[model samples]
Target: MKDPVLSHVRGTPNLLLGNYDLTALGYTVDEYFVAGTAVSYRPVGELGVDGHWDVVPAERADYLTRAVTVVPADGARFNGTVVVEWLNVSGGLDAPAVWLMAHRELLRAGYAYVGVSAQRVGIEGGAALVGDLSLKTLDPQRYAPLTHPGDAFAFDLFSQLGAVVRHRGDELLGDLRPERILAVGESQSAMFLTTYLNAVAPLAEIYDGYLVHSRFGPAAPLDGRSILDPDTVASLPCPRFRDDLRTPVLAVITETDLVGGVLPGYCTAGQPDEKFLRVWEIPGAAHADNYTIQGAFLDSGRAPIEDLAQAFRPTDTLMGRRLDRFLNFAPQHHYVLHAAIARLDDWVRTGRPAPAAARIALTDDESPTIATDSHGIARDGVRTPWVDTPLAATSGLNTESDRMSKLFGSGELFDTAHLHRRYPGGRTEYLTEFTTALDRTIAAGFLTSADRQEILELTAITAEWRFDPGAFHQSGSVR
Candidate 1:
């Protein structure tokens, strides 16, 4: 595969969500048409239960997909690391899941970010997990030239994108050299990456590390079956990461992903950590959180402390549907994801692996169940102040209602009686314990120190809103 032709897009890039001000962050956003021919893969030997797949190239097809990039305006700020995200089309559009979740870390650390439209659903039309908002549907004239052969070519199309970021950096990344390239994906895209890592990565050899976020049990099939397919839906097998990994791959599993609601959970595929792979299962976190639907767009690292406080409060709605309970507003999931990006970068650069974490407690059953503590909070897994030195009782589990709400999880605020019983000294004592726990989590390398101040500020806001209601006006607004 030769270097693909890169053409600048004249109009705005439809990233679907998280339309934050890039210029304010000392970064520039650009969209480019990546034109090339991609090779689809076929299994050479047998595709086994253990995720080590043996595959060969079978077919080639021409593809012209869009890549949305966020890079430092000046080349001097470039940190030499580029994160190529597999844009998730589970929502029926090109959604930058990782970018929305961790853009603060990527921008603050000077890493360039590119989101690839590697799947056919994102370009052409298909059955949607959310709405039918494909690129062509969004704007037929602007995205008219863009073509995706099919999801059969997505694996290789994504591989070629990594190559473009690396070998052709001068053209794609504004002459900024990328020393390390990391691949990241969330949910459905993570499933595709699982297949790519097992079947395609050995032959392509593109990325330095991978952040596979919120994947369920089964990896996607090489035959290009959508998750909605009846035959594919009937038999979905849980597969672990291949033991013989050549690069560092960090799997970040959330509580909702552990014991899946609509789909099979990742618990069935749990395995021991290897030299090249580590899994971090976070408790009190849904596959999607308040941050996913709200905070990411509002938090620019430049917002007023009070503004951020207003942004992250608990809400009862997800994409649009009013859920039965308040969605999980715990910031641990977002903070931990940011830390994962930093840890993976350092792991690739210094050859030092990230600190190991305890998996979430689960009950032994034919269908596993997450075990919880006395307060209805999950017991163990990547411990944080929110769950450790608690305020509200939180869990990754929610009423199995709609698919989106189920993944959003649920939270219940502690009543005044429960608050007084837990913290006798009130605000002062609670803050002290919370701060200590936060420090310990940072030392353990689960939370980054760079985020400590913001976390502290947010904690103060939450505590005040709960205990000192007079701090805000009676209109129920942050003042």
Candidate 2:
């Protein structure tokens, strides 16, 4: 468990200082490889399955592939290793910025990381292939069409991309036989991870975890929006992909990514009780901005990098004094990654998910609502100022609209004795009324949590035979 020392590049140590500057950053180069000729391909736009666009492959060629090993400057203790595979964002084989970030993070976290260029677009001889596709063109419509099924370019590229990583990862980590191996990808790389998992999961026993962030896919006609829609879920050809996945997955979604909309929807569609589907919804962050902004790719804040840097320091190192110098970036993203890694690590060591926090009851109300406490009694502004009632007190109610409205408004005694009997006590009667109103509100899709609570509480208080200020329920209080 000693902090791993960053190893130096073997031969041509001077070249490392001149080119990539690994030693300057405290990272030791473990190994490096220059892959052979790049693969040449053509993008032929044609209609494919389900009327979707696909790239009809025209040709193939060899290209240079570069693989590098990055280990921490001051190696931290880690029980596992992670392989960072970045999908070609520009459909080129060049090194990606995100890959660099992943390299830095993995090294700092005390895990050895390897980055491989999947295609020839960014590598030597990539110019010929990139020139064929004209990736320099920035038209969204053109890009969208090229990504469809009829075009075999994207599909073929991603398939090969996954193959290359699986081969390289197996070769590099053969002796280490690390306890856990994770494949991390972002954006297009995220989609590549999905493709890889579909094809390689059963065969690749070495891989224990998959982390897909900001996934993008083909667009669906129904939404005509991003392809990350529920409808497009059918587009993925992998059979029972979720049910069959043996490895745990961490699917991260950013609020602003329209292309990632299907992630949450897909997670919800699958069996949530399964340990494999770990979903995290990050708020107020754009796709990959959490890492880019902190890494100085954007002009927002420097705190995230500094925070990560501090985590890299030795235990006895006085990181507290310099903490103030770094900007204060929100830790939610970092924590999300940390949490996923921790869960994956735990599962690697013990054949089960790590202990999870109690499932909090999600509220439809927008105003930060919480459920009843351990006693199962929550007070809303209705029964007693501190109403004592079960968390789902409003579960039972009739479906009729008018009766429901009256019950939710000022408490009213229905002429039918049967109704009162069915509702039981005054609180029950009010809750039934509120539930009905809530049902209607849900249908209309306009009611906020505060509005629903107000309606329910008003109905309850109005029905009380004896009123007392102290007896009124307070909103959000769990009795």
Candidate 3:
């Protein structure tokens, strides 16, 4: 299949052999490119001042060198421009595949998208070498240089990309100047962004904002803590090096598997004035189920695209209603998701603050009813009392409740539509304590009215003292 956009770039080869010899090993090579057009508009203050938007394709150059093209919105009008470096995080997932899924919203929002294949492991020749050598046997010292060259190459490539974008401004884009550039990454790539920002802060003034999603890193052995510790990871001090970082940053943290880790560390760290940390604890969402389960908010049909091109506007009353299903799982976090996108677009276009915190209900027992707070002190209460009781005294209650928390928290109850099912009334008294504790928290104003209403509705249909059989069946566990 021919790529419509890349077919037009002059002197660009139809097929480029990368570091690997695919035919020699009976493997097929997949060609990915950065291909998209540009959009032009006027700046807010200056009525006549024009700006351009670009959409580029992702590509692989010489060994370890991955190049992505940036097409300006008005490629014919800019003198200088900005390049967006998009990094992928999933261990072996293709970065371009992820971008293709989410790029429509980005293109309409008026920013160029540049997707890089961050992992050499998934590339043509790179994959073959790892398979031949057996990743398990390769030594870290010897393997690091060959397998993961993308890590070191990203820093230089991004810096050079900015220079190239600036140089091509007159010919490709109009009289635009390459003033601001942004690096955005998700998951494991988020960790790399931190490393890159720290490593290149001294010479490059191009980076203006960073958008990190689901950031993860090596955990400490002693306490299972993330490597977000400043002393442990030398890269954290990079944000401090910038004298005046007009560049604003937004972090969207999903509370799927990131319970007590680097996310909390990054939030608390005192840093740049333009730096803002927002945690979106999406309730009931599995680690990578964001796309499948939370697809309602995304415009999957042709409506969003039509709306962007001024062809038609969608008036589906069900659009917002469909979004409500996932909202209860993580209300605050969902708001942050939209807010981060809006803020990034605003920063690129008008240089404004991200949308103010939208009105979201805070649940009283968001973490655990018994967990510690920001002060690092454990909270004590009648529900999660601090009394010195024997393990046997609370063993039955602890065992049952802990099991229930996992069941309800996993979102299987809703998935199975077992809200109306009743469990055998074997442990009514213990269950009452759990429900009552939830009620008391609501009454104490810790939980919002909406939260109380939802809980009450859920409880009414739920079995008073037993686990839902359907949930247990789906989970393949019994207690």
Q: What is the C-alpha local distance difference test score of each model?
A: 0.87, 0.37, 0.34
lDDT tens string, model 2, 8-39? 22443111111235565555555444333222
* Off by more than 4 A, model 2: 1-26, 34-64, 72-80, 88-105, 124-177, 204-206, 217-240, 258-273, 294-331, 354-479
Q: Which stretches of candidate 1 lie over 4 Å from their true place?
A: 469-479
Query: CA lDDT of 14 in candidate 3?
Result: 20
How do the candidates rank by lDDT, highest first?
1, 2, 3
Error of 3 at 204 (Å): 1.4
Task: Please report the candidate that would top TM-score against the real structure.
Answer: 1
Cα lDDT tens digits, model 3, 105-129, are: 3433334444444444433223220
Q: Between candidates 1 and 3, name the one with more favorable TM-score.
A: 1
Cα-based lDDT at residue 46, candidate 1: 71
TM-score of every candidate relative to the true structure: 0.97, 0.45, 0.45
User: What CA RMSD would candidate 3 show?
Assistant: 16.3
